[model samples]
Target: MTLKQALNRTREIFVANNIADARLESELLLRHTLNISQTQLYIDINQELSPEQEKAFWHLVKRRLNGEPTVYITGHREFYGLDFYVDPNVLIPRPESELLVEKALKLAQHQPGVTIAEIGTGCGAIAISLALNLPQAKIYATDISAPALKVARANCQKHGVLNRVRLLLGDMLDSLPQPVDLIVANLPYVKESELLAQFPVSSEPRLALNGGPDGLERIRQLCRQLNGKLRPEGYLLLEIGQGQETAVTTFLSNLLPSAEIEVTPDLSGIDRVVSLHLT
Candidate 1:
């Protein structure tokens, strides 16, 4: 079959199977299979697929049909318009987390030679995006999993931000060598009980999604460590899950009663990010 025919067939199968964005995903899988860009695929739409090419494409389609994420299958995810390398070892970067990057950039933009720390940097999307945007800032990207750091490191090299964004291996703030002017994070905030139901089974690392019995376990632990790690007047921006606004902001209030705490909602109007500014 021709490339266009193969794409049409895969899209139909995906639609029938109830996959969202079936056409887009089908195109992505096809491009990945042929190792070609979208332009090449369309330009060669009428060309017939080699027997081996058709076989390889079908293999990828089967994987997507069985519940593997397209990003994991293709090994690419875009955040802040930048491509990132992701795998099961690291949580796939989501659009909502871009708020953390934006808030961090804003908080750091005015501070000369600002220093920033991104806890749970995962694939290093947030840290790298920040590094590319704010060249004057020095970023520290930390993760508890060495494998996850491996992915982050690759992305840093891909983006050529390895010199600006340092990859650290440790839990939360422990890897931070000194106080930073801005602290940003997209930590795992899904309740441990909800993780299994919310995400595909074994599709992602448990360590990247688990937040204890309640969703705030890891957030709380990080909040406890913020005392000495943040420079005076530093800002903390966090990307949190839904229904976690009140509890998280309250905890921060009690911990630092004088600090100004604000919550920013995502495009859907759900409270998605909580930012704290220290005086």
Candidate 2:
């Protein structure tokens, strides 16, 4: 089949299954299968796909049809303009989480040699991105799941930031070697009730999604642990779920009543990042 024909068929299949962004997904799968660039694909749109390429493309399509995420199938994702290896072991990085990276970057820029810790550093996207952007920053990244850390470590190495990023295996800040100037986390915030009612993606790791009854358990735990882990005048950046602005803000206020707090919304106008500055 020709490239155009394959994409058309794949998109039709995805659309029939109610997958959003079918055209984009189909194109990505086709590019991965053909090992071709977007420009190359367009240039070769009318060219016939080799048998091997066609077979591989259809295999990936089948996986997508089975409800697997494209990032898992492609084994990579782009975050902060950098590509990171990803799989089912780690939660796929989303564009919304970039806000956390943005906030961290802005904070680190003003503090030379800023020490930072990333809680639940799945795929090491945030930590590595910060390390790349802030070359002088020392970053400690921790993940409860060793498998997720493995992915994160690989990404750190791939991005040439392994030397700057210390990967730790522990929950929250328990494994950090010392307090840091900043702490950033994209912890699991999906409520158990939400998981029970309707899980977002079954293929994703539940440990990376479940956040107790109200989706704020892990956030609360981190807040309680920030007392000594974060340096005086340090900052904490957190990526939260939609509509969680008020709850997370209130919880942090109660924990550190005098700390300065701000909520930054994503492009969709959802409260996606919560920034807290210690007194």
Candidate 3:
């Protein structure tokens, strides 16, 4: 069938299934199937698609309709203006999370050559972006799953920062060799009860999202373990879920009430990052 015909049919299917961003989804699927860019799609609107290509496009559409994330289907995502490979093994890099990287970049400006560690590196987007932007910084990244670490390693190489970012396989701070100048984490902070009720858990890895009973389990653990893992004058920049700011900050206060804590919001104005500078 012609590209135009295939695109129209795919749009209909997506709309009928109530898929979000149906038109954009159809365009991306068509682009992937035809191995062309959006501009090329218009140029080749009349070109015909092979049967194999048609089959592949339909498969992707079916997966999307089944609630699978488009990023996972495409095996790629763009974050902080850099492209990274993604899959079911890792949480898709998100725009909101870019704020965390931005905050880190600004903080790194004054502390060049500082050692940094990223807990739950997943696709290594944060660590790699920091290493790329902060050329003098050394970063260590960790993920509990080996598959996730493999993807992160490839991404580190893709960004040409493999030499600066070390990928490890373990949970939290256990994988790090020593306390770092900064500890940046986007670890799971979602509560157990809210996992199924609010977010798209079907396509994401659960271990990467579940934050235990109160959702502060990992963060609390990180705070306690961080004393031994962080430099005396260093700090921790963490990404927290919506409504988690007060809880996390309050918990941190209970641990180190004398510490300076600040909450920074993302572009959407949600309290997304918790910045803790040691006193």
Candidate 4:
């Protein structure tokens, strides 16, 4: 079959399986299988797929039909405009989390040699992006899962930020050195009961998704640990789940009573990130 025929077939299968963005997903799979650029794919649309290429394409299609994420199938995902390796060991990087990176960069812009700590830095997406953007800043990233830290460390090295991003394997803030100028986290905020219902992807790490009953447990724990870990006048940027602003705000306020707190929404206008300035 030709490239055009294969893409058409793949899209039909994806659509029939109720997959949203079927066409885009099919195109991405085809591109990955063929090891071709988008331009090359378009230019070579009529090129016939060798038997080997067809076999590989169908393999990926089956995985997608089975609900495996495309990023995992592709082994890489783009975050903050940088491509990073991904696998079932870590949660796939979502675009919404980029808001945390944006807020952190803004806070670090004027502060030279700022020290930043990232809690649960899966795949090192946020920390590596910050390291690339804020060249003068020192970054420390921690993940409780050793496998997740391995992926993060690999990504840090891939992005050439390994020297700047210190990877640690421990619970949030527990492994980080004290007195960091800024702390950013995108911890698991999905409530335990909501996990299967909200995110049915079995391939994603449960340790990166379950946040207890109200979905604020991990955030609360991090707040409790922030008192001395964050330097005075430092900032804490957290990416939270929808409808979590009130509870997170209350918790952080109670923990750091004099801290300045604000909520920043994602592109969809959902309350997504909570930014706090320590007193």
Q: Please report how far candidate 2 places residue 236 from its true position, in Å.
A: 0.8
TM-score of each: 0.97, 0.97, 0.95, 0.98
Tens-digit per-residue lDDT, 1-279, candidate 3:
999998888888888887778788888877877778889999999988888988898888888888888888888798999989999999888899999888888888778788989998899999999998888888999888899999999998888988889888887888889888899999888898888886754778888888999888888888888778888778899999989999899989888878899999988899999999888
How much does candidate 3 score in TM-score? 0.95
Task: Write candidate 2's Cα lDDT for 161-277 as tens digits.
Answer: 889999999978999889899999999999998985666657889999999999999999998998779999999999999899999999899889999999999999998999999
Q: Which digits, one per residue and each the tens of the lDDT, describe model 4 over residues 80-139?
A: 999999999999999999999999998898988999999999888999999999999998
Candidate 4, superposed: residue stretches over 4 Å from native: none
Superposition-based RMSD of candidate 4 using all C-alpha atoms, in angstroms: 0.9
Q: Please report how far candidate 4 places residue 203 from its true position, in Å.
A: 1.2
Write the residue-wise lDDT of candidate 1 on 163-197 in tens digits. Answer: 98999999899989999999998888999988878
Global Cα lDDT for candidate 3 = 0.87
Indicate whether candidate 2 or candidate 4 has the larger TM-score.
4
Clashes of each: 0, 0, 1, 0
Compared with the true structure, the alpha-carbon lDDT of candidate 1 equals 0.92
Error of 2 at 272 (Å): 1.5
Give the clash count for model 1: 0
